[model samples]
Target: MNQQALVDVAAVSAPCQGALHWVGMEQIALPLRVAGQTIAGRAAAGVNLVDPLARGIHMSRLYLALAGLDNQELSLVRVASVLETFLESHRELSNAAFLDLSGEALLNRPALISPLSGWKTYPFTLRCRRDEHGLQAILELTVGYSSTCPCSAALARQLIQQAFDERFTDTPVTHDGVREWLGGEQGIVATPHSQRSQAHLSIRLANGLDDLPLAAFVDRIESALGTALQTAVKRIDEQAFALANGQNLMFCEDAARRLHQALRGQAGIEGFRLRVVHAESLHAHDAVARSEWNWAGS
Candidate 1:
């Protein structure tokens, strides 16, 4: 059977010629290799329509450009190359390219005081822009940790002190007896409130880096927070975790400041902004604090 050939309208001239800043697809489902893990991701890929006389950009070309991500590990290098592919596919039609990939990355984490390990999922997004002049990439991810309110800790200590005074009003206070009392259930009459908190980090990476510093950043934040969420736990791990919480009490502002200071010392990051959200245990609303550094021009 013979069939008529369909005309390609996208190849024709526009009725009203006008340039478009960006022409592409958003939330395209894809599987990408990132940091040795295959992550299921959604990508937004596009380029500018520089040619005003052209009817439109070839959307299929932008879609095809995403195929490169499947083979290469997701990083600034991959982002730069894929963006270049987007512009090359629509050579005359585009001068600038943009790509955004969002997915969850899995990391295997060891328990604090046990010989067990488990996987933790971190939501991550990579965004990039490329043009004739230069290229830029940004990574955003979140870390979940525990935050014990400093004010709450102090109030709890005061209540314990009052309880101690009431219990031994007519007795002599000795260091051994006080230590015994602290080791007993009666010592901890009041406990401070702590809740699961999160730190969201957005960092601009230096150009031409070989790999994404995701693991390093996670380590940095977790170390600074000192009480990252664990997937598996034993009695020893729980006790160690309670000890860690006692040592690393912080407010939302402290969490933000710790991240800001730590990220500033990193080598591959040019700038960063961090938001710390403490899901308050004592109140109905969450406490949030934001900190940023070296992003004035960006």
Candidate 2:
């Protein structure tokens, strides 16, 4: 059997001063698990090889170490450990290390009425870094939700009322007559537009620890938002979705504010950044708002 040859690339050159140095690899694929589910993700791994004299780092070691990770043992905690390993393995060349993982997390959710459930995929990013001071980690989650236009609902109500007043001026005003008028063409009005929305939430941990339950955090956000979009739906599920849409009417700003409040109230969150984007159905442009929890000063 022909064995793969190992090369030593950590050769040092002349030392330099007052320069920020970084050395590592990117787009390294690894098997990972969050909440007991196996997933394949790509991580951009790096470390601050501050040794001004070092030629480069052991890039192959980083890939080999990550490739040995097992699904059963993969978690945020494991990720942080791997980062530590990367730093320690290159101790001669660097004193700091960073790892970034990007991939989709699939979650199965039950429908409102139907007994069947479906999977929803969310984009997720996990990052960890270590330095002389300590370690820091961040979890980024992306969620998709539906937004309804409150203004349109109000306008629709007003148009129906106006149509009723005009059509029933000469005849007796009755519930059936009003319903018919509201359902007719004159009562049908151009509704204000609301669109499907998405939010990117990032939470920073106080320590370098990454033991938080990512899947559970995502579930909490999904539940707080009431309804999440799905890949597959039956008739019953569709009707239930319509009901949910009618009940939860929110503007772009309203959604952002709500998420801000929710994240602020969540336990174990030291710092957070929230960004909400609404793809408007009425206009060509999108509306976005961002909020960040300032922990450095406060």
Candidate 3:
């Protein structure tokens, strides 16, 4: 018997005619290389269908083109190439291509005052868009930290002072006695409220960058916050973290401002939008503040 040709429905004209802004696959499972490690990742790959009369662009071509990312380390420059391949394959059909790759980036972070360290995961998504203006990449990630409320700290201090005045009314001030009292629970009437906080950063990259700069950016943001959440700690490290929180009390506004300052002048970054969220311990709701630089107009 003679074989018949298979039909391609996607190649046929659509009864309803209009071009699509985005069309392809989402929630695709893929393995990605980040920081020299193979981390499981999910992706959404697509291209713009400029042909209003055509049914669709070649989706299989986009899926197959993603294979190029499997063997190589992920980076803006590298991803740009894959997008170029996507455009080349859909040369006559699509005028733009996009790839959105998401995964958790893991790095073993050392304790504040100990030899111990533990793995920390930063959830991140990288997006690459290629159009007539050329390729542009956007990196978004979340970094967790500890934020002690400044207002709470001030109120706690006032209560502590009131308690001290009442307790020391009759006793003469002595260094050892005062120190002992300060060490006791009665002397330290209250402590400031603190909560685990997160900074969500979306950064646009300048041209000619080779890597994503995830690790470096993580370190910088954590250092600027000064109270990054710790893992695998000794008693000494715990004490140090406590001290850090006490000394570095801030509101969401402070955190947002700090991140903005830290990200400024960072090499390879053109613009960014950052949001700091403080999950309020005293209230049921969260407090958020946002800031952007070189991004408002763009």
TM-score, model 1 to reference: 0.94
| Stronger candidate by TM-score (2 vs 3) | 3
lDDT of 3 at 196: 99
Clashing pairs in 2: 11-55
How accurate locally, in lDDT, is each candidate?
A: 0.88, 0.75, 0.92
Give Cα distance to truth, residue 61, candidate 3, Å: 1.2
**Tens digit per residue, CA lDDT, model 2, 1-298:** 8999786444546445332466778887777775666778788888886766666678877887686455644466676678788987987778888888877877787877777887777888878777886777778999998888888878877876676677778989789877886677766655545578998898886563446567777777766676578666799888888778777788777777778777777766788888888888878998888888854632
Q: Report each candidate's C-alpha RMSD, comma-separated, in the order given.
A: 1.7, 3.4, 1.3
For model 2, the superposed segments whose C-alpha errors exceed 4 Å read 1-20, 175-192, 206-210, 295-298
Q: What residue pairs are clashing in model 1? A: none
Model 1, 167-215: lDDT tens digits are 7888799999899988899988999999999999999988778688888
For candidate 1, the per-residue lDDT at 253 reads: 87
In what order do the candidates fall by TM-score, top score first? 3, 1, 2
Residue 7 error for model 3, in Å?
1.6
The local lDDT score (0 to 100) that residue 282 gets in candidate 3 is 99
Residue 88 Cα positional deviation in candidate 3, in Å, after optimal superposition: 0.7
Q: Name the lDDT value of residue 176 in candidate 1.
A: 90
